[model samples]
Target: MERKLFLKNGLAALGLAAIAPLANACKKDTSGSDTTDTSGTTTTGGNSSTTCTVSPTETEGPFPTKTPGSLVRSNIVGDRTGVAFTIKIYIKNKNSSCAALSGALVDIWHCDKDGYYSEYGGTSMQTVDYTSNHFLRGRQVTDSNGLVTFTSIFPGWYTSRATHIHVHVYNSSGTSLLVTQIAFPEGSSSAVTLVNTTGSSYGYTKGMSGYTYNASDNVFSDDTAALETAVVSGSLSGGYTLTHTINVSA
Candidate 1:
């Protein structure tokens, strides 16, 4: 009898642990009062550590999606070429005790594989003259489950900035809540090193010679790397998938 009880309890505990990360994705407090998700807290990078802290607010420039409201599609890969990357961003309401923030608007934009951004170029910032071109940028609204996904290409690095993706979140009323950027890990097995090192023939010609790392990046250098870093998976051949939960005070 004692052995059977132990097995049943262990299985139930495993089930709850699996749902912990999605549970802390966050929700909205319609009544204007503090609410908490009884689901659980976040599990960072497959670790046992759990917390529901608000995502750090960062700038959305050097470049931003010029007309994000008009680009409402899930797939933002418009003629760009490089390794495939899928972005899954979970928005949680810090004010609501880290419940999933349903129905929020999210805008994400990043540079192409060769260190180029569409819509604006040829000036001092971008010398490529892609002002008439638009790619690698799009917008999406969170589902009732507080999640938004985007189809894009694996981004390349540029001067002064490490590999990153810019994000802008808004309330249902279209009010801007936070502007931030997603950072990636740098290791032998990470895309940051592989995409630039062994991806030259694959069109990632920029290489990692003078690449900027997170430790030297201006925005994430202030110890915000841990808070903004995303958990990226997959490989050079099969493409990559990135998952990061952003908590907001909405």
Candidate 2:
């Protein structure tokens, strides 16, 4: 686990889609407003917030079978070794124009600072450290507008590609209708350098450009300059923000 030497060596290579509208309701208030007068005083009131209500919609597959998972590593909660960062995935069901999708599940999983996966019930990438169970994974449902958010740390950098997160969007019926992964821009030198510094020490491979970002992954057929990057915020101690939107309904 040496420092400078780890960056100079080490290399490894390998590797490897929506819904419908429910219902819409429109209420027209043609009647005039009612006013009350008392002692030369008048008062009027109405609904302050607009509400969108829809009828029951059909359920689909591949959704979570049990409770949701967690993406943040519990052990590294306060670790300020420059290896910590936050990842926030924004979820929305654009297909539901009539009403916002509520209770729509979103499951996300990624590697840890050491490039390891929890595997849930299986094993891949690295061994399944029981302690890491559900450490870097989580499941959340969209709110009234089909929106959900998860607070996790930035993923570690592996060989041959930029930092990315694997996302799964499922309906209430546990059917996984959409499977996709989003990546950050390869231009963040500071973020890339941090990955290289932390991962290199473990004898892991280094990024071709000394940083991690998109624009290099062959899997992202739609990988464009704009789509490759995401918005990240946070401090080196707590973590950073990772925000990106994917247009799946289109």
Please give the CA lDDT of all the candidate structures. 0.71, 0.41
* Weakest ten-residue segment in model 2 by summed lDDT: 1-10
Residue pair clashes in candidate 1: 25-92, 26-92, 26-98, 26-99, 26-100, 26-101, 27-99, 27-100, 27-101, 122-129
Candidate 1 local lDDT, residue 131: 81
Q: Tens-digit lDDT track for model 2 on 19-81?
A: 011112112122213242344221222121122221111111111223444432223223213
- The most accurate candidate by lDDT is 1
Q: Identify the runs in model 1 with alpha carbons over 4 angstroms from their true place.
A: 1-50
1-250 per-residue lDDT for model 1 (tens digits): 0001111112321111110112212221121112112332112231110268877778666567888899998999998988888999999898988888999999999988877788877665566777887798989999987899999989986665668898999999999988888887666446676778788767987666556576666676677677788877677777778888888889
lDDT of 2: 0.41
Which structure among the candidates has the greatest TM-score?
A: 1
> Candidate 2 at residue 173, lDDT?
76
What's the lDDT for residue 150 in model 1? Answer: 94
